[model samples]
Target: MFYEIVTSPCYGTVEKVAIDKDSRIYEWEPLFAIKNMNGELEVIKMGCSGEVQSLEVEAGDKVIPGMVLAYIQEDILIGGSD
Candidate 1:
């Protein structure tokens, strides 16, 4: 198992948090809602399915491009120790 970091793609304020710690998330699932600088709302989605390990930001938090939003823990099937 390994962790994947979820990052923000724009400068905005977090409008809503869609998942909680330890929650399971699916690919393309909504993770957060952010209101961008131009007052446009953007819904951020998960790129891969995994269990949420931690959340780095919350609703109402300010975020910039490439900022970390959460950590996701996923199983890697290619290599494993039995």
Candidate 2:
């Protein structure tokens, strides 16, 4: 599955990118973090295990809540269900 990861609810400027494209990451892993307009840090986490497919935002980029940050292509589990 192609999964999209968005920024946290707190609007902010991207302070850092914790992962890179094609990087393998586990579920709940830290994908990226943003520094809110209020100077608070917000971390966006991966919801599933997968390889990073793309990154839409970079460090120092301005971002808002729910902004697309990156894409993750989740591992396929074939024959796992009937």
Candidate 1 has an lDDT of 0.93
Q: Kindly list the per-residue Cα lDDT of model 1 for residues 1-82, writing each as its tens digit.
A: 7898999989999999999999999989999999999999999996688899999999999999999999999755677778
Residue 75's C-alpha lDDT in candidate 1?
Answer: 52
TM-score for every candidate vs. truth? 0.88, 0.82
Residue-level lDDT tens digits of model 2 in 3-69: 6565557778888898888989887887788888878887778668888888898989888767788
Relative to the true structure, candidate 1 reaches a TM of 0.88
Off by over 4 Å in 2: 79-82
lDDT of each: 0.93, 0.79
Each prediction's total of clashing residue pairs, residues at least 3 apart in sequence or on different chains, is 0, 0
